[model samples]
Target: MASQVDHRYIERLFRAYYSGEVAEKIFHSAPEPEKREWAFLRLDGPMVRHVKLTSIDDLHSQLDPPPKGIYYSLSTYEYPDYPMPDKQRIKTDVAFDLDADHIRGAVLQEVSRCKSCGWIGEGDVCRECGGEVRKIQLVDDRTIKSISGEVSRLLDRLANYLDVDIDRLRIFFSGLRGYHIHLEEEPYRSLDSVERIELKDFLTLDGVEIHHAKEPDSAIIRILEECRDVLSEVEDVSVRQVLESLVNSKDNPRHFTSIRKRLGEDRVLRERVSRTVRELCGVNIDPVVVTDMSRLIRAPYSLHGKSSLIKTPLDMEALEALDPPVIALASPSNNMVKVHVDYVPHLIWGGREIPSIHDEDVILPEPLAIYLVNMGLAQGLRHV
Candidate 1:
């Protein structure tokens, strides 16, 4: 809607914060319990003001992990509103915790199983497919832009092609390699290991021959049933196009010339959009894709239950005890922006806290905060 999302503006935003001295991260009060809560949107350095809005969510990931490969880019984004300097950019990389290990540089190795099929690789070849046994890395910095871009583009296509709602299509960054596109439907819980593999088979490669008993048009039926509610919310075609472009880019903000392409495109009139919402409401096959990467976790550990079921807490007193606790103003737009960063885990339902919610709050962990400040300054994006 505005010229606020271009390279020149983004570069200026990042360069300013990254060049300055690192600042303390801050938090605020949400409007009401359901109304509003304060949270930190940690930038490369510190600076919050003049920003229209902000959003930070988990990364899109594959349903399962790959062998000997830990995903580094489980979550990443581009806020033309707040670009990070190169150094801070690398430091800001956040990985989802599927298990206990270093968030960054996670590596998934083949111990005695097929990364793709789980067919125990006791020898040089797998007994199932005889495919040469070798671990494929699941996540890394190199793949972040590519995988994220792919998911964004795919979702755009699915929304436009099937006339589905973009909001209904939840996208996840897999903390490491690629993204996970999950349809917001209850049926997702029912899918088994084999079925998930089947999904991957269908998206990356075509002409899958799933059993007929599942349903004559199970695949087609899956997409429709899961995405029905979304059709009603497709108010903006251009947003979908912008989203698609975002997912397909290997870099953030994409090419300047492409932004011009958006300027020339046609708009979807309100009358037509209203009619489309009244007619459609469902998904056939829930489309999900896992960009090919080396592995999911470098060292995988079994969790007792899904993220929704877990609640780990940190002692606020102890967290505050950590040496430095002052907030820094990284970006000009964020100098006055108040926000909070949560450390809760994903669970069977929405994210649940582990007693830690009330214990203490740190906008960014010391390590992560330092990384952002140091790197941002290194990239000449921070200013004192």
Candidate 2:
């Protein structure tokens, strides 16, 4: 209902980030998609459609106001000008999106508002008024760490297990939230929708079982074994005790009846095992991104309008210790702005603990300043 998005700021960002990248290798090598298919652009209001371009020059020429989101289609075609979707002959690239926001722990705290009575609360429901809820954006440092670890495992699986060459892989930050790993090599690039779905199943460890955890080192085996190891090596006293009971039980632990009956009496023990299994097993990939060949993903190195962070290359070392806000702020020059903070849960940025303050001019880095403003947690001060 209210416009929290700063359209003018987005326009400036578009120009700033993309102006010089027109002639880069990524644009030139993968020129077919940009040349043949349609690209979507989000303008000041709604995303404008049917925006087409033939060259790198055309891209810079067209983005006059700068789009909040820029997307390119994954479907490659012969005579791509055809209006119908079936006409596209080949689909290129199997894309993986591992977003941090999808991680539950990453969402450290939640701010929700009541629809009927405008009651704001700490969680999803309106605790006081008992009304319908709307979510407000919040921060998560843990998810960033968790998702990045999964991404590294994914990269290793692709290279060592799947035999996908390291040279063919292109890994980038998804601007905010997570990472995007694109498989653009031959054979893999031309895979159909069904084959793509198979890839998705492989990465996500769908229908995984204990028998699948044998040697010869497949991704499935690796995932299952990892989960087993985490469970076996758990340090939590309660969780470890429950696992020990399961191990020492006369009945087979794999049997559902045995597992449930042995541990079901204690909800906490069941939860601990479930949580451990969830945390260790499988790569947290967005299924649709891999299964659907026609899906569009955020362009590599593009700026996410919401977070004001660039989708830059992700090195393993930097990814392990990634702080999205901190990385987004480290640049050529400081993006400084003044903000009037309303309220936010403890925000840790640049090794400083920023507490909840009211009506005070707090100098913040541009990325954090804009993030807080967009989250509806704080307002940006004009002419501060």
lDDT tens digits by residue: candidate 2, 135-187:
77564454355566677777876776677986667777676676788787778
RMSD of candidate 1 to the true fold? 24.2
Cα lDDT tens digits for candidate 1, 1-384: 112232232334333432333111110111111111111122222323212122211110111121111112211223312422321111111112222122122332222335466454245677787666653222222333323333443455445544446565433333222333434332333344455455444333233321111332244334333344453355567543433332333243334235334433433432332233222221111222232111112111111111100011112232223112111111123221111222122111011111222112334222222222222211111222
Off by over 4 Å in 2: 1-5, 16-26, 29-38, 49-52, 84-87, 104-109, 114-133, 140-142, 209-222, 232-280, 321-326, 329-333, 350-353, 358-360, 381-384
Instruction: Show where candidate 1 strays beyond 4 Å.
Output: 1-148, 156-166, 172-182, 206-369, 372-384
The number of residue pairs in model 1 that clash at the backbone is 111
How close is every model to the real structure, measured as TM-score?
Answer: 0.22, 0.76
Which clashing pairs does model 2 show? none
What's model 2's lDDT at 345? 59
